[model samples]
Target: MPMPQEYQLASQHYESFLTAAREALHLTTRNQTYTCVQATLLVFRHRLTAEQILMFADTLPAVLRAIFTSGWSIDDFKPEFGDEGDWKAEVKAVRVDHNFSNDETPARVAAVLRQHVDLPRFEKVLQQIGPDALRFWGFEASARI
Candidate 1:
């Protein structure tokens, strides 16, 4: 059967997000494996001059959480020893809490992440992350293609 029009449009949006993220991944980073997390956090950290962190903070975490819920092992990307917590852990905690493994922790962490991001900054990051990634992750970008 043909894919639904909504799914097709979402795939397009996801493609755009992948492109933006892929571009961001290439810019510069100390770690290659954590490139996506780095890019996402760079977006979250207000480090990107063009992007706002708050606007897309919620969506970013949602995308990450969905990925983990789908059975991806975040532990595959270990944080450097002495690093307090990174995006990978943060994303995992959200998924675990959502899945009832832990409840209160994700909320607190989400709040902290929110504080670090602002809507305007996040909007810019969203542009970086692309509407496609969001839609691909199941966040609504448009009602129709």
Candidate 2:
């Protein structure tokens, strides 16, 4: 039997995420990329409103959408979105097993996400999120991509 279209699309989406993440981090394995992607998703989600987070997840591919919501807790409080350094520290603290580097890992992960996701739709979703959105993606507030 032929492969189902949904299965093929899901596979393609996952591969695209891994490929971009691996290339960004110069990593050898999708597992390593997955760690970074997962960590980034968690860290970023913590900073967004529940509604914004869901909107962002809706914009992602199937595998990424799953990763975004994996292990999420609805009753959890949204952390304060402080400066970039504070956010990076939180990411490191959240994924100590992955030993997330201060800035590079988040930047690489965000770059990978940008590479795979729909940019304009993402921008629209975060339009109300202000500079937090930009900084989370390792962008300067005024910087436009």
lDDT of 1 by residue, 1-145 (tens): 9976544565454344444443433423223313343333332242222222333434444444233234323333322311223433443443242222112222333333333334445444445665543332233445422
lDDT of 2 by residue, 1-145 (tens): 9986655799787887789778887877777777777777787887777777788888788888988988777665466777767767776676578653456778888877877777878776766677788778755667653
Off by more than 4 A, model 1? 1-6, 27-68, 72-85, 88-145
Q: In the order shown, what is each candidate's alpha-carbon RMSD?
A: 15.2, 3.3
lDDT of the structure predicted as candidate 1: 0.36
Error of 2 at 16 (Å): 1.9
Please provide TM-scores, in order, for all candidate models, with all chains considered together: 0.27, 0.82
Candidate 2, residue 122: the lDDT equals 76
Measured by TM-score, the strongest candidate is 2
